[model samples]
Each structure stands twice: as structure tokens, then as C-alpha cells.
Target: IAHGEIFLTTGGRSMDRRQIWSAMKRLCQKAGVAPSKVFPHNLRHLFATAYYRVYHDIVKLADMLGHSSIETTRIYLIESGAEHQRQLERLGLVS
Candidate 1:
């Protein structure tokens, strides 16, 4: 990795993935969030969901995310039941 790309370091060495994950968990705990709910992979899903919501272009999203199959990218876009309900309500089909 390039020096400019290194964000976290210890004793002149860059932090590994495990160290980054642990640091994120600790930061979340300090912020009154559940450490168990803080994970590195979840950020990828969050980014995918938010990107898809904004652009509504699954093919481009799949390519940007480096997914070989659009099906794999679809997994990242799953929404919560409450969010789905809110979207349906926005349609204003019912009184």
C-alpha cells in the first residue's frame, strides 16, 4: 500500500484489517453503539444500498462494486421491512 493511502499506523507499520476492525468496534462502543453491531463488511453493504437508492442503476453499481453477478450485488441492497413500508406509503395509493 502507498504511504498516502495509509490512515492508521502503529510503530511505523500500517494497521492490518483485524486492527482496523477492532478500532472501529472500540470507537462505536465509545459512541454508545453496540460493538457487536459494528462490522467492516457492513460498511460495504451500507454503501451499496445508499448508492443504489440514489442512482437506481444496478448494472453500474454491480460493476463499481466488482461483483461478477448482479445477483450478488442485489444481496447488498436488501431493505428493512420498515423502510419498505415507508416507500409503499410514499406511493399514496391508499387513504
Candidate 2:
């Protein structure tokens, strides 16, 4: 568990789930956003969504996410619908 820090705290120690949740809640409040919309898993989903948008390769995304199946990584793609349409429009493949 070297460094034991997948997510670090302000004091440079590993952050517990509760700490991350609380911090996210606080940030959401300060931003005047719904706290329910902010969670630790959302960060992973955002990263996966951005990476997939650039690569457009699910197999590679699965590898990066250390997932045994692409289906698991697929759960992270929240922008699938609108982003797909935007890509099509950008390519002039559809009006």
C-alpha cells in the first residue's frame, strides 16, 4: 500500500470515502449545485467520457480503466448520446 494514496487528502494522506464525499458535498454547495449530482464516481465517469471522446476506442478505454470487460467501461460514458450526434455533425455525415 505504498503511499496508500489513490486519492490524497489536503494533509497529503490518503482520503477516506467519507472525506471525499464530504468535500464534494461542500464544493457542490459553494457552487450552488445539487450535492446529489457530485460524487466520487462522477470523476471517474468524466475521465472515462473524455478519454473515450478522444480515442473512440472502447477496448483501449477498458485497458486504461483496468476493466475485464468493455461493458464495465461503457457505464462511464455519460456523453454517449449528444457527443455522438455532435461528432456526426462535425464530420458533416449528417445534418
Question: In TM-score terms, which candidate is top?
Answer: 1
- lDDT agreement with native, every candidate: 0.85, 0.84
Q: Global CA lDDT of candidate 2, please?
A: 0.84
List candidate 1 segments past 4 Å from native: 1-15
Candidate 1's residue-wise lDDT over 1-95, tens digit each?
53343546757666777987988898998999988899888877888988998999999999978899999999888878999999899999976
Models 1 onward score TM values of: 0.75, 0.70
TM-score, model 1 to reference: 0.75
Runs of candidate 2 with Cα error greater than 4 angstroms are 1-6, 78-95
Give per-residue CA lDDT, model 2, range 1-95, as digits (tens). Answer: 45346778778888888998898899899999998799988877888888888989999989977899988888787556888788888999666
